[model samples]
Target: MKEKHEIGALILRVVLGLIFIGHGTQKFQGGIENIAGWFDSIGLPGFLAYIVASLEVVGGIALILGLATRVVGGLFVLLLLGAIIKVQLAVGFIGGYAYDLALLTISLFLLMNGSKLYSLDKLLFKAKNN
Candidate 1:
């Protein structure tokens, strides 16, 4: 049923959002500068650490609320892809890219489906149509 699918999406969105929030919080707790330094060591611009951290936190909230879900999901897909390719590729799948791959798939699903019900996007869309 359509409602079942909507519920499924909601569950996925909330869980994924929580995961991202935890990761972003961890980055902050561990020191963004340290993350930046690590990024630099990995051949990424150190400044990107701030951007990535911000996105993870802010985007996680957006996802939980289902605000601009597609956009946030799109960004997450790119972010995960970059992590998999740039950082985890050499480490192999079992403990390396596996998590990232899972996250990427969830993001891709959200990107494609957006949000249907019990979401800010749905509320706003309905309001606009009324």
Candidate 2:
């Protein structure tokens, strides 16, 4: 059971990491100016586009490497929350919010559980069972 649980976490982490990385790359390739313009159109600070993009890229890498899982997951949750509020909410549930909600739930799970097996967190922060 424990092994299965760890494997599940590993799968979830990698999938989520890849998804975030892809989204981040899209934001970049789509042009920061365009994204910032979209952000401004949505009544958000344009500068935030850059910040969010950087976070997604860096956080995605952290997730993929299983480094600082709790921290990265927490940040991802916050980011998703912002997306839900600023964009997904306007799109309505079936339109888009459901996806952000799912991502938020997954991020929350990772935040609470941290990395399991096959993670740098496990290797570097192994508990000393004295």
Best by lDDT: 1
**How well does each candidate superpose onto the true structure, as a TM-score?**
0.96, 0.93
Q: What is candidate 2's local distance difference test score?
A: 0.88
TM-score of model 2 (CA atoms): 0.93
lDDT tens digits by residue: candidate 1, 53-127: 999999999999989999999999999999999989899999899999999999999999977667888787887
The superposed Cα distance between candidate 1 and the true structure at residue 110, in angstroms, equals 0.2
In candidate 2, stretches whose alpha carbon ends up further than 4 angstroms from where it belongs are 127-130
Candidate 1 is scored at a TM of: 0.96
Clashes, model 2: 0
lDDT of 1: 0.93
Please report, in order, the local distance difference test score of every candidate based on alpha carbons: 0.93, 0.88
The sequence of per-residue lDDT tens digits that candidate 2 reaches over residues 1-130 is: 8888888888889888998998888999999899999999989999999999988888898898898888999999999999999888988999889999998998998999876667887777778312
